[model samples]
Target chain A: GAGVSQSPRYKVAKRGQDVALRCDPISGHVSLFWYQQALGQGPEFLTYFQNEAQLDKSGLPSDRFFAERPEGSVSTLKIQRTQQEDSAVYLCASSLFGQVIYEQYFGPGTRLTVT
Target chain B: QQPVQSPQAVILREGEDAVINCSSSKALYSVHWYRQKHGEAPVFLMILLKGGEQKGHEKISASFNEKKQQSSLYLTASQLSYSGTYFCGTEFQGGSEKLVFGKGTKLTVNP
Candidate 1:
């Protein structure tokens, strides 16, 4: 089976530009999550979705960030007016169950660099 | 709060053993371990739930201590393939589904 995957492995944008990163979770995974990882640091939570319903978004840095999982499988994280601080690798993960006890399968991630 | 991991980095030789520890201030429901190579996604090593259960792989093992809100990952007879950054993700008992991660422990195994 194919593992989790993300599109646009790398991206560079002007500070004020908007960017959208896409994620394709493992087939049939009901729980999806997004995270941000800065260089030499651990991944920080961003948001999560259980099917089409977003269960949590408290980890989002600010209003400039938003995410959606409309069909419950594919997800997108959009950043408006990107800042240099927003430069980091965006990671997407998924688990078979909604429970936190389940192991999360991660994607390669999309590295976003804001200039 | 983010859990704290000990020994920010470690260097080892093949056939040796090492232990990485994680401690959380808040009560935890589970501890998840992951290893990541340079320029790659994190790979799940194991998950330890509450109740102090121990899980094992060929040469890897983990233990959860609910009372202390801590977990330990053990690597025995280390292999070259085991070199990478190890992270511990803590899920609070009453917190959301998100897992708060520690900085990371970089492990380098030399042959």
Candidate 2:
């Protein structure tokens, strides 16, 4: 089977511009996650969703960041009025179930550059 | 919180040993180890559940300390293929499964 996939492998946005990153988790995965990784730093959790219901959004840095997984499958992370600090790799991941396992398949991530 | 990883970077000769430790202030239920090559997604290596269980893959093994909220990765007879950045992701014992990763330790193995 195919692994998780993200679109527009790279994006460059002007300051204050909005951008939307898309993620298609592995088919049938019940748990989806979003992470932001800065250069020279490890990936940081952004948010998470169990099916169509978001289980945790506490990691979202600010109100400009929003994510949705409608239909319990595809997910989109939208950053409104992006700032220079938002320039980082946005990673999406999916696990087979809830917090019962340690394995989570990650995508290549979308490298967003806010100029 | 971000775990603290020691030896921010290390260089090892083939057939040598290296140790990387990750410690957290919060009690953890599990610690996950991963190695990420340059410009790639992190690949999972192993997961250590709370408690002092040691698991080995090839000559690479790790130990977890539940009380201190710390973990260590041990690499033996290091091979050139082992060169990469190692990261420790911690999950609080009882919470939504989110991994709080530490700044990775970069390891370079020379033949």
Compare the candidates by DockQ and give the number of the best one: 1
Model 2 lDDT tens row, B1-111: 799999899999999999999999989888899898887888888999987888898989999988788999999999999999999998986775789999999999998
Give each candidate's interface RMSD in Å. 0.5, 1.4
lDDT score at residue B101, model 1, on the 0-100 scale: 96
Ten contiguous residues with the weakest lDDT in model 2 chain A? A96-105
- Please estimate how well model 1 matches the true structure, expressed as its whole-model Cα lDDT: 0.96
Which stretches in model 2 have alpha-carbon errors above 4 Å?
Answer: none
Q: Which tens-of-lDDT digit does each residue in A1-115 have in candidate 1? A: 9999999999999999999999999999999999999999999999999999999999999999999999999999999999999999999999999987799999999999999
Expressed as tens digits, the lDDT of each residue in B1-111 for candidate 1 is: 899998899999999999999999999989999999999999999998899999998899999998899999999999999999999999999856889999999999999
Error of 1 at B59 (Å): 0.4
Runs in model 1 deviating more than 4 A are none
lDDT of model 1 at position B62 = 97
Among the candidates, what TM-score does chain A have in each? 0.99, 0.97
All DockQ scores: 0.93, 0.68
